[model samples]
Target: MSSIIHILQTQGGEIWSALGQHISISLISLFIAAIIAIPLAIVLMTHKRIAEVILQITSILQTIPSLALLGILIPMVGIGTVPAIIALVVYAVMPIFQNTYSGLTTIDPDLDEAAEAFGLSRAKKLVKFQIPLAMPMIISGIRIAMVMIIGTATLAALIGAGGLGTYILLGIETNNNALLLIGAILSAVLTLIFSALIKAISKLSLRKMGILFATLIVLFGGFAGYRSIVKPPVNVTIAGKMGSEPEILINMYKELIEEDHPNMKVSLKPNFGGTTFLYKALQSGSIDIYPEFTGTVLQALVKTNQKVSHNPEKTYQVARKLMKKDANMEYLAPMKYQNGYDLAVTQSFAKKYNLKTISDLKKVEHRLHAGFDPDFYQQNDGFPGVKKAYGLDIASAKTMEPSIRYKAIANGKVNLVDGYTTDPEVKEYNLVVLKDDKNHFPPYQGAPLMTEKFAMAHPEVKKTLDKLAGKISESDMQKMNYLVTVKHEKSSKVARDYLEDKGLLK
Candidate 1:
């Protein structure tokens, strides 16, 4: 109870932002889906036979898994709101389409005869009679779509479109049940409220509904106008990938910049898609700063496998030098910790098999069910490299969301799962991190990657980041992660506590 209270108190700001995003994304997507679905359903209904074929096409879209759809969308559209909105719109089409078709076709033929007798045109008949008669069913469809969209909007955070899912993902990564509960409960509540609001709106008469629609358009237009005319509050925007250590480091930067300057208007954007997404965003100047690892930048960005240094400090120096020389970003001074990837198994699994290292897994490779983060499959030095280096052949390794991977391993869904050395769940779940005895993976020294122009523009912020250099050791990071992931504390609170303890913040 106390833990839950602390989380609410600590993460109140985040909850509010997520709620706004949740509402905006769901509403916008629903609005767009309605525009597409209504006309398509009208056309299909007129053709009769085409309705079944088109509905089936939409059914196929509805059948695609949300994660799979997002995976396809991310690569093609690039990550962020556009892909997420498009996915939601796709999800919503079936409900709206099916309902609108049902409504239009099932309408009384007598009304069409009466309209024809009055010499009314097709458009006038639809506006005056057909649509009005079908109002209840169409509204029901919209209500259902809105409800579904609200729930699905949470998944948008996975692809860097911030929504309520941000808290849930962070909660899962930290192993914090409190955080998870808060996100789940809040999402459910938001869904209910949105459903009720849509239902209430649907009950209004046609003229009233038109008024409501006009009002929404006006409000949205005004907001857009105001945003364009007025400057945004956030001056410096930095993002981080979805993980505990990344969360911690990003919060540390936020705390330092905000607390020191008191009114600097810094915006710390969390819940980036992945390393690849962040790298592209940094390169394209979509984001100004983010925490990235030496080895990840080496393998994912520069493909530095040929001359990658195995040593942590040397790797940081190498990555830093190259990033400055070759990329739009430059590496800041690194944190003290060297958080490399680990192949983890449940403690019981390790004890049962007496497995101590990656090489040991080769003996029982076929027996083990494997799971990893999807990003791992993309990196040159990730799962494939692990497979090649260890000479192990596991027929199928499922790629899952990083947050769920820990639970998946612990629950016996998978014998082996990917983990980071600094991950709190490793300790919290009693997972054994099998050693990379062959040194197949390179060193991953954690550091901030900032847009070089941004760094040059704000030397004060650079100096502030430099203060964090070599301050947090591996043990220190593990303890902080443990507090958030296992103990269910907010990362802000955890970071704040550590910084105060270290006398970095007062």
Candidate 2:
């Protein structure tokens, strides 16, 4: 129960912000879709063959899965709002298109004849009679499209599009039901409000021309103002990771710039995933900067087959060389801490077996229960790699979220679990971190990966990040992780506080 409240208090603002972004993306896409679809509908009414072909084409687009469409668009349009908007618009087109065509075609021919009898031209009949009569159906179609787009907008959070989807994804990732419920409710309410507005607009008589014109003007003006106010500078695009670490880094940078260098305008584009995702974002230029581990970049790009070294400087140098030669990227200065993977066991279980290291576990391997994250089970550096390096195979293994693995081990659900060396829970739970006698895992030296172009353009930014390099020891990293992941503190606030303590921010 306390945990629920903690999640809400910490994540509420993000949930609200995500909701706002989701609504913005959905409505903008719906509006654009209406503009294009309405015209296409009118054209189809007049030209039967073209309308048939177009409707079929749009239907096919509708069949494409939303996430798949977004993925396809990433290479062509890159990430963030543009690709999200495009995918939403494509998804929305068919409904509005079908309804507009139906509404126009279903209108009585006698009404057109009556208009002609009154000396109205074809254009006059379309504008004054056919369009007005078909509006209710068109509006209904729009309402449906808006709801669908709102729901799918949550997926945009995956690509750092910043919408209500952020809450849903975070909730799922952290297993927070309250956050999920709140996000879902907010999306539904927003959809209802938009649908009601559209319905009211459809019901309004054409005689209220002044009111209608004023409303349209106000909406357009509001949108223009919003675009100007929210749009970050054209010069700098800030991209980072989605979780606590990225959030902390983003907040630190924002505060430092705002307080000390207000002249520079920046935008934050956060992508949430494991190290591989952030690395790819940097490599593709979808992100300007992101926090990464030197070992990950080295292994992923340089030599997946090579053994990992504990020497942070050597790892950084190797990663730096690979980035320049292979990825056209740069490895920024390392952080003070190491976030390397650790093999953990509950204190009671560790004491009973007198287990303390990978070698100590060898005798008890067949009797011990193990837990691994799903990705860890599959990755080359995960369980299979551990087994190969240590020659210790546990009696049972279950895959779960990394955050929960510690708790499961603490509670005796599992005797052994994979954990980050610096996780605060190691201290909290009094668990034993078995020494890596064979050094299976590499030194996960925390750092930032940046494009050569960004490095050249913003040398000061590089310098600012470099100052923190090798400053965060493993214990410091673990405490910071605990503050955000376990304590439920806002990542941004925590990051800002840390930077201020270090005199990194004015």
Candidate 3:
């Protein structure tokens, strides 16, 4: 509890910023959902069949898995707040629409007749009678949607939409319980606050409620417009894939770039997402640069069936050449460390299975339950490559998040998991990594990757980043990962210390 308080005390500014983002996005999405759902619900009253159809569609939208929906939307709408809001709106619309429609349609027929007998027009009846009578049901729906939006909005962080989930994801990746607790508790608190606020608003006069909602909408719109117009133009935006390593690397990039050009504004988006998300963001010009691995370039992005070379220089050369030719991206010289993929097991499990090599896994293939990240499970150079190279096909493989896999194996939830060579958890968990005797996995030396166009335009930036080439070694990275993951140090501080230690920073 003291540790959590300390983190809150030290990082209070970041926590507030993230909390503001969480509230902004959630309210914006809920507002939009209400705007669409409420009027449509009112209009559908006379057309019962059409109303049913629309409600069924909302139900279908509600049933679609959130992550899967976000995955589908990324390619179309791109990432960040737009896609996150669209996904939330999709989830939010159903309850609001269903409740509003049900409440309006199911109003006592006697009251409707009374309104008609009083010479009330349709609009007047809705305004003075139907809507007021149905207000409670509508407010209940809004409360439900508001709570759901607050909870679902955390996923916005996955797509670079800033929110409290940043702390949650950071906590999970670095194994920091304090950060995790902060994010979770804050999120829960926000939900309760919004739910109660909606309930309180429900007690207000209709005119007051209208004034309040209108004020909120104007405020939200003005806030969004102000952010876009008021902020300094970002000259460089560097992003990184999920993990402590990427976070450290991007911090290093941001620090170096700013040091080189004092007047330049550089932005860092750490733990943005997986390689594909970052790559697409780069292609769309949403981000300027990110750390890329040589082997991932060859296998995942370029998808070349070229001969896999074990030599670090050879692999980096191939990656650099093809990346420019095929993907229109520049691959800088890689650092000395090879953060390659490897299969790991507990020390006890390895001893029991007598596992010494990738080929050894074949002996216990049927008995093994493999936990691999979604990227590794799907990439040709990951599980599929392992199967083809070693003729070992383990049927019981499950897709797991990168951070959770370490805990999963440690707790005996699974006997095997895929991990990077430089990951500190390999040492912390006392896990033994099997040798890839067949050399199926290629060397994954980290390099600064950016669009060729960006590289051409920002030669100074490229030069600044090139200083990292051949800088970080295997032990250097492992130790840095250890410092962040095990010691719970800030990535920015860790990165700065490394740069100072190596005399890389000006």
Candidate 4:
């Protein structure tokens, strides 16, 4: 509890900023959904068949997995708040529409007859008789939608839409339970607040409720106009994939670039996503720069049928050339370290199997139980490549989160894990990496990657970032990762310290 309080105190500013963003996105999504759904549902009350079809469509939309829906929306609408809101609205629509329709349709027939006998027009009947009676059910639907939107809005972080999910994802990646608790607790609190607001609004007179929604619409419009006129354009937006290493690297990039160009407005989106998501984001112009690796560029980004060279320099050259030609992206000079994948096993397991090379796994393939992250389990350059190059496949394999795989192996829950070379847990868990005797794994030297257009326009930015080329050594990166993941040091502080120690920062 003390640790959580300390984290909140130290990171209070960021937490507030993230909370604001979360509320903004959730409210926008909820408002848009309510406006679209309630009106359409009202109109469809007269057409039962059409209402059923529309409701069925919304139900199907809700059935699509949230992440998959976000992925699909990325290509059409791109990432960030727009796509996030669209996905959230789709999920919100069904509940609001269904409840509103059910509420209106289930009204007492005798009340309708009384309204007609009083000579009330259609509009008067809906406004005076039906709506007030159905207010509870309508409010209930909106409440349910708001709760769902608030909860699922966390996923917006994956696509660079800032929210509490940033803390949650960072926590999971770095094993920080305090950060995780903060995010979850805050989200729950926000849900309660919204629930209370809905309950309050449900008791209001129709005139008062109408005034409130009208006031909200006006405020939203005025804020949008003010933002369009007031906000300055961000010159550079740098992002990083999930993990302590990428977080640190992006921080270094931010510091170096801002130091060189003091007038430039730079933004950092840490733990933006995995390689493929970041790559797609780059292509779509959602993000400008991110730390990437030579092996990932060659194996995942711009896959080639030709054999890749094992030599570091040669691998870098091949990846650089291919990215420029195939994806119209620039691959900056790589650092000295290689954060490549290697199979790891406990010292006892290796000793028992006499495992010195990846090929040696063949001897005990049947007995081996492997734990891998989803990316490694599926990527062609990961498990599949290992199987093809070494003719070894474990008898049992399970996919788990990257952060948990180390613990799984260390606890003997699994005997093998797909481990990164620069991971601090490799040493902490006393695991040995089997050599890639066949040289199947390509060099994974890290570097900043950007689109060609951004690279050409900001040559000075490239020069400043290139200063980091060949700077961070393998041991240096491992130590930095350890500082953040094990010692609980902030990534930005660790990055700044490393740069200061190396005489790179002014």
Candidate 5:
């Protein structure tokens, strides 16, 4: 409980900002959904067949996964809050549309006759009596939509849509359970609060409720107009992979880059899929810059490499050339340290198996259990490609989060974990990192990768990125990783401390 409180206190500013974004996105989506759905439902009511079909279409859209919907919107409309809001609106339309149709169609026949006896026209009957009489049900539909929109808005972070979900994803990536809990609880609370607010609004008399509508208009228009009018100074976006090392590197980059270009506005967005998803995001312009390792770059796409190369520089050159030729992305200078994959085992396990190298472990591979980060598993240069190259396939292989892989191995949940060379937990847990004797693992020299257009377009940004090349040594990166994974230091703080010590920060 104290830990949770600590996480909340430290993240209060971020929380408030996320709340505002959450409300803005959800309300905007709900408003749009109501506009389209309420009218469409009424139109479709006259044609029962079309009404069923329209509802079916909306329901089918709801069936699509939130992430999939977000991804689909990326290539078509681009990323950020636009795609997120569009996806939310798509998801929201169903509840309100369904409720509107049912609410109107279920109205008492006597009400319709009464409206006619009062000399009301068909349209006037709907406007003055039917819709007003069905107000409770329509509001109920909106309540449901609002509740869902608030909860689902968390996925907005995946597409760079800022919300509390950012904290949840960040928490998972950094192995901060307290942060994860706080983010989840807050999201749930927001959903409940909106649902309650809508319910209260529904209970109010129609006259009072109409005034609330005016307030909503002012809030919505002001918020939307403000977002559209206000622009960032430079609008440079920096994306990073999900794990601690990548996050630390990117944050340090952000600090350095911003210091270099004070007038530039910088935003850091972390992708959960690491290189696997990040590279594609770069191609689609979802993100501008991210740190990548040569090893991962070698297998950036599936089936691109038949085998992993042993040579580090060669791997870098090939990756750089391919990225340029294939996607116009430039691989900038690599840092001094190489954070390669270390197929690690607990000290006790190593002692028991006499495991000295990757090949040695391969001998008893059939009997052992292996766990790898999803990023590693997905990369052809990652576990699968490496394993195939080395002729070792542990039948009992499981995908694990990068942050907890070490703990999984230490606690006997997994016999082997695909650990990073820079991970401090490998040393802390007294684990034996098996050597890649066959040189199956490629060099994973850390470097900043950016689209060529962005590089050429922003020379100062490129120069700032280049200045730090080969600066962060193996030891320096390890220290930062240790501080976060073991000492519980925030990645940004660890990065700041490292930069200050290195005299990188002005």
Candidate 6:
């Protein structure tokens, strides 16, 4: 219980900010949905045959997964809040539209006849009789949409739009139950409150319009207060993957430039996935910058040979050449850290066979269980490439999350595991990192990859990052990774402290 309270206290600011974002996204989406849906509903009622088709089409959109929809929108609209808002509005349309059509259609035909017989035109009957009578049902539809949008707005966090989903996704990745519970509970509470308020307003009489007006004033006034207080931009956006590395870079950029840079403002737009996704984001302009490994760009992006070289200069030059010629990207100065792939086995397993290198592993390869990431298992330059390069045939192969693969090897569930040389857990688990006698894995020096335009615009950025070049030894990087991936330190704080300690911060 105390831990829960502590978490709440620490995350309270993010929680409140997420709430504001949630409200803004849900309300704006609902307003847009109502504007379109109400008019469409009236038309559908007037043309009864098309009502079924329209509802079915909207239902199809609702069935499409929110995450998938966001991905589809990336290439077309890029990232940030605009795509998120468009997705939410589409999600909101179905419920409101169906209810509105039903509401207007179900009204008594005799009431319309009576209004028309009294010399009232069609527009008059619609305004005075049909619309007023359908108000309750229309409001109910809007209420449902509001509740739905409040819940779905959590997904906006996946695209770095900053909502309650940020906490939930982080919680899932880090195994923090408190964050998940808090995000869920807050979302539910917000939905209930908004739904109840809408319901109450719908039931109110004309004399109660004052109460409704006051509610609107307070709501809009609070929005104004939030806008003034936070002062986040209305247009600028920042996007990257969701994890410690990306988070650290994004936060540093936000602090260093977003707050101080006058011409253009910035906000985070995060996505959850692998390096491939981050690369795709950069290519499509969904993200401005992200941390990427030199070897990954070489092997995955450039389709180069997978041979580790001791000389960092040569490796970087090749990487730079490939990125420029192929991907239209530039590799910034390498960070101090290097995260090369290492073959690891439990100390017990290594001792049993006296395994020391790729050559030694090959002798007993058929007897060992191997685990790798799903993509790593299938990539042309991944498991297949490893086998071809090393000439090893393992008894079994399994795919799992990168973090879990380390634990599997440490616990002896697998005899061999693909590991990052700079992952702190390698030291913690006392595993044997076999020497790459054949050099199957390439040098994976850390570097920032940015578009040509971004690099040109921020020439000083490279100089700012150069302070880290060759500063992070493998041991230091392992410790830093542990601090982030294991000790749960905020990445920005970690990066900033490291930079300040190194006198890189001016």
The TM-score obtained by model 4 is: 0.96
Judged by lDDT, which candidate is best? 4
Please identify model 5 stretches exceeding 4 Å from their true place.
110-119, 227-231, 301-308, 347-356, 360-370, 396-400, 404-415, 428-430
Score each candidate by Cα lDDT. 0.82, 0.75, 0.90, 0.91, 0.81, 0.75
Q: Please, what are the lDDT tens digits per residue for candidate 2 over residues 396-506?
A: 999876656766887778888887776677777888899988887877777777889889988877766666766766666566767876665656778877887877776
lDDT per residue, candidate 6, 397-458, as tens digits?
99876666767876778878876777666777788888888776667787768888777877
Backbone Cα, N, C clashes tallied per candidate: 1, 11, 0, 0, 0, 3
Tens digit of lDDT per residue, candidate 1, span 75-163? 56766688899999999998998999999999889888989999999989888978888878898899889888988888888766888
What TM-score does candidate 1 reach?
0.87
List runs of model 6 lying over 4 Å from the truth: 108-120, 127-137, 205-239, 249-273, 284-286, 303-313, 341-419, 424-440
lDDT per residue (tens digit) for residues 331-377 in model 5: 89888888887788888888888999888977788878888887777
Q: Which residue pairs in candidate 1 have backbone atoms (N, alpha carbon, C) closer than 3 angstroms, thus clashing?
A: 174-485
Question: Which run of 10 residues does model 3 get worst, by summed lDDT?
Answer: 71-80
Model 1 residue 244 distance off true place after TM-score fit, in angstroms: 1.5
lDDT of 3: 0.90
Show model 1 residue runs off by greater than 4 Å.
1-17, 39-87, 106-110, 159-161, 219-232, 260-263
Ordered list by TM-score, greatest first: 3, 4, 5, 1, 6, 2
Measured with C-alpha atoms, the lDDT of residue 252 in candidate 2 is: 64
- Per-residue lDDT over 1-506 for candidate 3, one digit per residue giving the tens place of the 0 to 100 score: 99798998999999999999999899889999999999999999889999999999999999998877877777778777898999999999999998999889989999989988989999999999888888888998999999899888888888878899999999999999899899999999999998888889989988998899889878888987999999888899889888899999999999999999999998888888888878888888878899999888888888676796988899899889888899899999888889999999999988998999889999999888988988899898899888888888675889877889999999988999999999999999999999989888988999999999999999999999989888898999999999999999999999999999999985
Best by TM-score: 3
Give the clashing pairs for model 6: 160-270, 238-269, 336-472
- Model 2 scores a C-alpha lDDT of 0.75
